[model samples]
Every structure is written in C-alpha cells, then in structure tokens.
Target: MKSTITVSKKVKEVLERKKKEMEIKLNKPLSWDEFFQNIFREEEERIPKLTEEEAEILKDLTKEDRKNWRIREFV
Candidate 1:
C-alpha cells in the first residue's frame, strides 16, 4: 500500500536538508528511514556495553521492581 503523511513545510525542509547532508556525508542518498536508521545505529554503537557488575545490578533492580504477579488458564 502507498501512504502519505503530513508535516509542516518547515519540518519537511529541515528533513530535506538533513537528507542532503547525510547523502554527502555517507557518499550516497538514502531514504528518510535509512538516514534516520543510520543515525540510530551509529548512536547505539557509541553506547557503552554493560559490565558484568552493572548487568547483574540492573537485573536485580528490575526483579525487585516487578510487583504484579498473574497466572492464566485457558480452555
């Protein structure tokens, strides 16, 4: 299916400018999704991986935070 979305002209202009900048930066033009995805991927790559201690602490914190418990049976 084809779809259309509406944004303010200013927003569209900014996105077009960003697209052009990314095309020059990456040496190829990309669709808006591709352009944004590349930025997300780059940002994700820059995030530090959790250490063992941090991972364990996060796990414990999440476990402690869980409150509701439920069981379901279906026939």
Candidate 2:
C-alpha cells in the first residue's frame, strides 16, 4: 500500500533547502527519512532524563507544592 500527501510548493521548497543545508552541515547526503530521523534523535537527546529520586519526588508532591510549581490537573 502507498499513501499520497499534499504540501504547498513553498513549504516543499523550504524543506528542500533545509535538506541541502543539513547534507552540507553533516558532510553527507541524506534520504528524506534520514533527514527527519536525525532531527528527532537530536530533540530526544535534548530532553532531560529523570532519576528514580526525581521521579519519586514528583510523584509525592502535594497539591500545594504542585500549585506553587504551576502544575495543573484537569478533573
């Protein structure tokens, strides 16, 4: 099976330019999937990892402490 999707020509042009920029920056050409994979991989690396102690502290936070931290829970 195959899927067809639509993109504006302007958006496609920007993506093409970005792809060329990335290929030059990395000193290698990339397939469409490779281009996006590198982006998502870098983003995942930027997110902070939590230790067990940190997870426990967050789980044990009281409503008041959570409020002070500006955390919200919808009923």
C-alpha TM-scores of all predictions: 0.56, 0.69
Residue 47 accuracy (lDDT) in model 2: 98
Which tens-of-lDDT digit does each residue in 1-75 have in candidate 1?
657899999999998998899899989979878998988998999999999999999998888877555566798
Model 1 residue pairs with clashes: none
> What's the residue-level lDDT of 53 in candidate 1?
98
Off by over 4 Å in 1: 57-75
Local accuracy of candidate 2 as per-residue lDDT tens digits, 24-70? 99999998889989889989999999999998887778655766786
Q: Which runs of model 2 end up more than 4 angstroms from their true locations?
A: 1-3, 62-75
Quality of model 2 by C-alpha lDDT: 0.88
By TM-score, the best candidate is 2
Query: What's the lDDT for residue 50 in model 2?
Result: 97
Which RMSD values do the candidates have, in order?
9.0, 5.6
